[model samples]
Target: MGEVRLYMFQTGTLKCKYHDIYLNQGEGRDWEIPVPFYVVDHPRGLIVIDGGTPVECATDPHGHWGATADFFVPVLDEKDGCVAQMQAAGLDTSRVTHVVLSHLHLDHVGAVGRFPGARHVVQRTEMDYARSPDWFQVGAYIQSDINRAGVDWFFLEDSWGDFYDLLGDGTITLIRSPGHTVGHQSILVKTAHQNVLLAVDAADTLDHWEEKALPGALHSAVDAVRSVRKLRAVQENTGALVVAGHDPEQWAAMKRAPAYY
Candidate 1:
């Protein structure tokens, strides 16, 4: 079996209209969320899930996404930049062999260019949306780095049954849980100690998963709800540790860098 480690790369608070959607009521209170990226050190190589926001977001927040940017997300400094944090942990960016993206949102796919050698695994539907987005419906958040870097992109179309043995021992498996985006997915890592499920954006916080809540601003409200239920079912069946997309409590509990998992 292979060993796995999870690192919390970023932690920040965001104020978005969608927060109420998850709450199922319009609280009008700014939603304080935590943004984190996980690193899984399997037998194969170092694998990163969901690249956090780039450093540029903190510098030129308005320039990239304009006014709406601040409305949805507030960038955190320490955990925002992946390169800086990785270097501190003594891990060279070049060592990353694979990158699993939950979706192509600006907050998630910001630092994709850092690891040029790494193969990017994403859902084909998400890639299509990033290429040609319906601005009126969903916000445009695709970064130019994705196109600039000649990345080896692996697009999953139908299901995630193919990546059953990521760790070569049935430990780490990528679960395709579509909801937030048409191609949104989650990671199921079964470690020696426990089985952990990284529900990246599939459920923003534990509140969403526990209460079956749907964020207000989503591509499809019904689909989002369905995804949450699917994740819950997995949690029930496997008894895995369910980590939400953005939960401040979970992020705070995790060890940063040098100290992994």
Candidate 2:
């Protein structure tokens, strides 16, 4: 195994409603947040966690996202797509071997087409939800893109907990953590210095984890709370650096152009 380093690809940022009660007391406020996609350096190749919004959707007036678009809008120019961000970091998108998605939310899976050659990994339950969604309950942002890409797919059928070695080298693991969605998960990158847990939408912001707050709207509020507690235990047990799904503070603290370890 080689030393693992993390790079934040700021495809864009958006002004979203602050969902943490401590921050807003049940009231919503506009806040700037990073639509961050992460890249991990592994011994075998680079891996990207959650592709941010695609550049084309930015101007699609009748896009599927609807009003939520205004909340998690992409502020980056078309030229600043994930591919461009990867190039800026001295890494090519084509070199990425795998792309792991936490869920199929439009904001999370928007750039699925960017890495056509890479295998796309998603939970089996999430795929089922995407294929036959209760349109009234869920949003379908990547359904068309997923159908068009014809990308290779790897589905996780069994429960994933403890640890998972993606490359069979004990370097990269996807720690199963459900609740925000049926198959929501967090990525654990074991680096030489310390382990990093990319807690996707399991916790949308740092406050969600720090305050143990749940997402305002969830399929299951109780389950969401349980997931948050589970993640907290994982963070405490491993002593890993935890990164939230869309924390504005994380984006502000990160170096935009070059990659950071």
The CA lDDT at 178 in model 1 is: 70
User: Which digits, one per residue and each the tens of the lDDT, describe model 2 over residues 1-261?
Assistant: 457777777767665566531333446765566788888877677788876776666567237466656555556677667777787779866678998887877667755757767888888877787777676545544566556557888988755544567888666777666767767778877777777778887888787787646665355666667777888887788898888887777757765557466
The clash tally of candidate 1 reads: 1
For each candidate, give its TM-score against the true structure. Answer: 0.87, 0.87
lDDT of 2: 0.71
Could you give candidate 1's per-residue lDDT for residues 102-209 as a string of tens digits?
Answer: 888777875576786888888787888777778753454545645755888888776545244454666667776676777787888775567788888878777777
The per-residue C-alpha lDDT of model 1 at residue 228 equals 79
Please list all clashing residue pairs in model 1, or write none if there are none: 21-216
Off by over 4 Å in 1: 17-24, 137-140, 143-145, 159-168
True-structure Cα RMSD, model 1: 2.6
> Distance (Å) between predicted and true CA of 200, model 1?
1.4
